[model samples]
Target: MSNKKMSGFTIVELLVVLSVIALLLSIITPRYFGKIKEGQEVVLKQNLATIRHAIDQYYSDQGMYPTNLNSLKEKRYLRDIPEDPIMKNQEWQIIKAPNEVGVYDVKSRSNEISSNNNMYSEW
Candidate 1:
């Protein structure tokens, strides 16, 4: 047999490729996660708006806010309680009206600060 060496990538070549891939991932991963966070924030805002609108509509029709979020759903004012995207849970921080008899407003259960540098609950 001839003494020619086999042609293949060396260990250095493999390491270089791996490092390039890692660098790309390091550069890309944070931006991707940031975008995901932004999307979730948008969804959270929309859900909050929808729920607030439902509460207002319920108040207009019934002359008072519902006893709970589920009451809105029960009365068909809302199809269902919207999930809090930031909190990643269905739980909402229910705000009571002046009389403390029914919901006056809602907020996210998450205490995490948003990209806007405000608490998610304050949103």
Candidate 2:
């Protein structure tokens, strides 16, 4: 009989391959998770900028900042307050002037942590 080598991988060889794949995944997963966190932070910053710009424009047109976040919606400045993606639909924090001066500061209501560990509300 002619000597022939088997082409199929042995069970031991297969196990080694699987183990290597698992090791690689373990090394890579955390990096991917970190990237996802960073992406969320970028999105939050963009949302913040958009809201700030809308507020500025509203102030420019109406001669003052909105008295409350609802006023922005009432005046048709924004379709609705954009949901804070990181915060999972939590209502934004609205800081209205206690003295009734008609200026409001808006921020996220949820304490969602950013990639840098800063709260989304503080962004």
Candidate 3:
């Protein structure tokens, strides 16, 4: 019989490698998701600020708030309505001015708790 050397990983070696990979994944996955959420939160904050700033500029220019986000876009106060980073949509919770008939402020539609331990809507 001719002698032939095996050129493959053994079952034990494969198991060890797989187990190590799984262990590393277990340790890393939660943190990865947390970081993703954190990134989304930062984006959410910036989007909110941008929309609010646009609303303020519109109000300042017109002496009243725009009737809706579309109005801002119509007059070029905003190029577009920003997507809510957390909700992944353009919907927002609009607050009317105390005595005015248009958007006075905007908040995230998401009620999800943020990393800072505050509701996203409250951001």
Candidate 4:
């Protein structure tokens, strides 16, 4: 009878591999989520711009701001209200120009601070 050692990973080797994976995940997870958040912020800004432009076009043609965002959609100035990427909804902070009766501008309603240290609501 001949005795031979089995070729396999030791318990210590498995633990070391798991530890390395965990370390890598710890380093990568935060950055990944942060990048995602930044992308969402960018999308929010673009959505605001698109909505603003639609309002401008509506005014240019109709001679007054749309009464509401849905009016833009009804008039075909926009296919739809752009979603607020950060807030994950179409709810927006509609701004009327100082006593104007209709929306003159729009902003994000997100309370989360952006990477630039500005509150999303300020954008």
Candidate 5:
């Protein structure tokens, strides 16, 4: 048989390919993570707004904010309380005005910082 070698990537070529892939991943991972965080923030904001609206409506119907979020469920204002994605099913922060009829403050259960570097709790 004739002496010959089948064509295939050399060790150096394989190393180069791996290096390129690692570099690409290093560059892309942070951006992808940032997008995921942004998506979470958007979802959190929407959920908070929805709950706030429901609380307002509850007040309009009943003339006062429920003693607690559970009251919403008792009154069937919501099928169930929406869990905070970041907090993984923890109760959200809720603040009621001393003499007002509805919620004056609502915030995420997760304390994740936003793009502006403000904690979700302070939003």
Candidate 6:
């Protein structure tokens, strides 16, 4: 018989390699999705904080809350109203000012639950 060994992987060896790759993917994919969702949540929180800060600044400067989100951009309090990451929209749940003439607090219009078991709006 010839002394040379096989030059490439056998069918069984190839199957083992494929199974290992699949196992690794199965383990990694869920964590990857979890990280993406976590990142979106973080972005949502930062956007909310920025918008709230802009609202406060507008209130302090104008002596009233903004009449609308657009007023903040028009008056340069914010370059733009930060879009809600979770809802994938710029539509914010505007809380009216106590004076009944302007925006107060804001909330997410999304109904999704957060990691803390609260609805995104409640956050």
The 0-to-1 C-alpha lDDT of every candidate, in the order given, reads 0.93, 0.77, 0.90, 0.88, 0.82, 0.91
Q: Candidate 6 lDDT, tens digit per residue, 11-113? A: 9999999999999999999999989889989999999899899999988888888889999999999998898989899999988977479989899999999
Per-residue error for 31 in candidate 6, Å, reads 0.7
lDDT of 4 by residue, 68-122 (tens): 8999999899998999988889999988866667888888888888899989999
- What number of backbone clashes does candidate 3 have, counting pairs of residues 3 or more apart or in separate chains? 0
Ranking by lDDT, best first? 1, 6, 3, 4, 5, 2
User: Please, what is the TM-score per model?
Assistant: 0.92, 0.79, 0.92, 0.92, 0.86, 0.92
In the range 61-91, model 5's lDDT, one tens digit per residue, is 9888888888888899888888787787748
Two-way TM-score contest, 3 vs 4, winner = 3
In model 6, the worst 10-residue window by lDDT is 97-106
Candidate 4 lDDT = 0.88
TM-score of candidate 6 against the unseen true structure = 0.92
Evaluate model 2: give its lDDT: 0.77
lDDT for each residue of candidate 1 in 68-107, tens digit (9 for 90 to 100): 9999999998888889988778899999999659999999
State the local distance difference test value for candidate 1: 0.93
Residue-level lDDT for 21 in candidate 1: 100
Stretches of candidate 3 off by over 4 Å are none
Comparing 3 with 5 on TM-score, the higher-scoring candidate is: 3
Residue 53 local lDDT, model 5 = 82
